[model samples]
Target chain A: MLEAIINILSWLLLLAGGAFGIIGGIGLLRFPDFYSRMHAAGLTETLCAICIIFGLVLQAGISLLTLKLLLILLFLLFTAPTATHAVARAAMIDEVEPVLSEDSPRLVDYEDRP
Target chain B: MRDTIFLIVLLALLWLAISGIYKPAILLLGLASLVLVTWVVIRMKIIGEEHNPTVFAWRLPRFWLWALREIVISNIHVARLVFRPEQISPRIVYQNVHFQRPLGKVIYGNTCTLTPGTVTVQLTKSGTVIHALDAKSADSLAELERRVHWLEGETDEVAAKDAGEERR
Candidate 1:
C-alpha cells in the first residue's frame, strides 16, 4: 500500500512539473517581448525543475538518488532567482521601457507629488 | 583556512547523503571533516553563527513559497502577451535598489534576469539596469525590487545582530 501511494505521488509530481515546464515554454515562445520571455524561463527553472526533482525522489525510493535530487533542487532554488534578477537589472539599466498595465500607478504623477 | 576544511566537509557530507551508504567509519570521517570545515569556514569568514544552517532552515522555505507564487502569476501574464504580440513594447529602464550587501545585490540582479521578458544588463551599488520586452516586465521588475528590498532588510537585521554579538 505504501509503495503504491509513493508511486501515485511520484506520478502526480511528475505531471505537475511537466505541465509547468510546458506552460513556461509556451509563454517563452508567445510572449511579445524579451522580458516576458525571461519571466517564463525563470518560471521553468524553479517551478518545473522543483516538481520534477521531487517526483524523481519519490520514484528513486529513498537512497543516494534522493540526496542528489535534493542537492539539485537546493542549487536550483538558490541560483535561478539570482540569474533572473541579473537579467532584469541589466535590461533596465539599458533603458528598456516596460509595457504598463492600464491600472499601473502613474509614475509621472507619483514623482511630481510633493 | 578553516573555511577550506568546512567546504570539504560539506562536500563529503553531501556525498554520503547522496550515496546513502552509512558505514560507521564513513560516518566518523564525515563528521570529522564537517568539524574541520566548520573551523576553517569560521576562520575564513565564509560561514558564521549568524548565517548558519539554523537561519537558512527557517528562511529558505519561506523564500520558495513566495518565489513560486510570483512565477505562476508572471508566467500566465507572459503567455497572454505572447499569444498577442501586439502587447510588446520593448524598452530599457532604470530602477533604484537599496540592498547593502553584495549577496543581496546578486540575488536581486539574478532574480530579475530569471523572470521572463526582462534581462539584467548592469548592476551597481546604487541600483540596477534592465531591458524589458515591454513596460509590464519593467514594472514587474520594479515591484520585485520592493520584495527583494524587504528580504534584504531582514538579512541586514540579522547581520546587524550578529555584528553586535561580535562587538560584545
Candidate 2:
C-alpha cells in the first residue's frame, strides 16, 4: 500500500511539473518584452525543477542515486540564479529598455519574429 | 592559510561523498589532488579572507529555509501574472544593501534574482538595481533585504562603518 501511495504521489508531482513547464513556455511568447519574459521563465524554471526532481527522488528512495540527484538539484539551484543575474546584467549594459508601467511595453509580439 | 586548509577539507569531503570508495590508494590519490588544487588556487592570488565562506556555512540553513519559502510564494505570484499578463507592472528600481560585507551583497543579489518576480539587474558598490515584475514585488524587495540582513546577522552599513572606524 505504501509503495502504491508513493507511486501515485510521485506521478502526480511529475504531471504537475510538466504542466507548469508548459505554462512557462506559453508565458515566454506571451510576455511583451525582454525582461517580463524573464519572470515567466525564471518562475517556472525554479518551481518545475523542484517538482520534477523531488518526484524523482521519491521514486529513487534511499540510495546513492538519491544523493546524486540532490547534489545535482543543489548545483542547479546555485547556477540558475548566477546565470539569470548574468543575463539580466548583460541586458542592462546593452540598454534593453524594460517596460516601466502597466499598459504597454514594446508590443513587439513573438509572432513578428521569423 | 586557514581558508586554504578549509578549502582542502571541503574538497576532500566532497571527493569522498561523491566517490564513495573505501580504498587506501584512492584516498591517497584524492588527498594529492586536493593539495595540488589548493596550491594552484593560492598561487593564482584570488584567495582572500573574504573568500572564506566558512562563516556563511552556519548562516546558510536559515537563509535557505526562508528563501525556499519565498520561492514558493513568488512562483504562485508569477503563475498568476502569466495567466493575466496585464497585471504585471514591471519596473526597475534601486534597492539599498544593508549589510556591510561584500559577501552579503553577493548573497542578497543572488537571492533577489532567484525569486522570479524580482530580478537583480545590476549590483553596484552602493546598491542593486532590481527589475521587479510589479509594484508589489518592487516594494517586497525591502522585506527581502531585511531578511538578507537578518540571515547574515550583520548590521546596517552605517553601524558597520562606525565599528570599522572604532577598530582603526
- Provide i-RMS per model in Å: 6.3, 6.5
Clashes of each: 78, 0
List candidate 1 segments past 4 Å from native.
Answer: A1-12, A26-37, A58-64, A79-114, B1-9, B22-57, B133-136, B153-168
Q: State the TM-score of candidate 2 restricted to chain B.
A: 0.82
Lowest-lDDT window of 10 residues in candidate 2 chain B? B153-162
Encode model 1's per-residue lDDT on A47-104: one tens digit a residue. Answer: 6887799899988876767777888887887777666666655655575645554534
- Considering only chain A, what is the TM-score of each predicted structure? 0.84, 0.86
DockQ each: 0.30, 0.35
User: Which candidate's TM-score is highest?
Assistant: 2
Per-candidate chain B TM: 0.65, 0.82
Q: What is the alpha-carbon RMSD of candidate 1 to the true structure?
A: 8.8
lDDT per residue, candidate 1, B56-113, as tens digits?
A: 4545465556666776566566656656767666665566667656766766766666
| Residue A81 error, candidate 2, Å | 1.0
lDDT of 2 by residue, A20-68 (tens): 7888888898998988888888877788888899899999999988888
Residue clash pairs of candidate 2:
none
Poorest stretch of ten by lDDT in candidate 2 chain A: A105-114
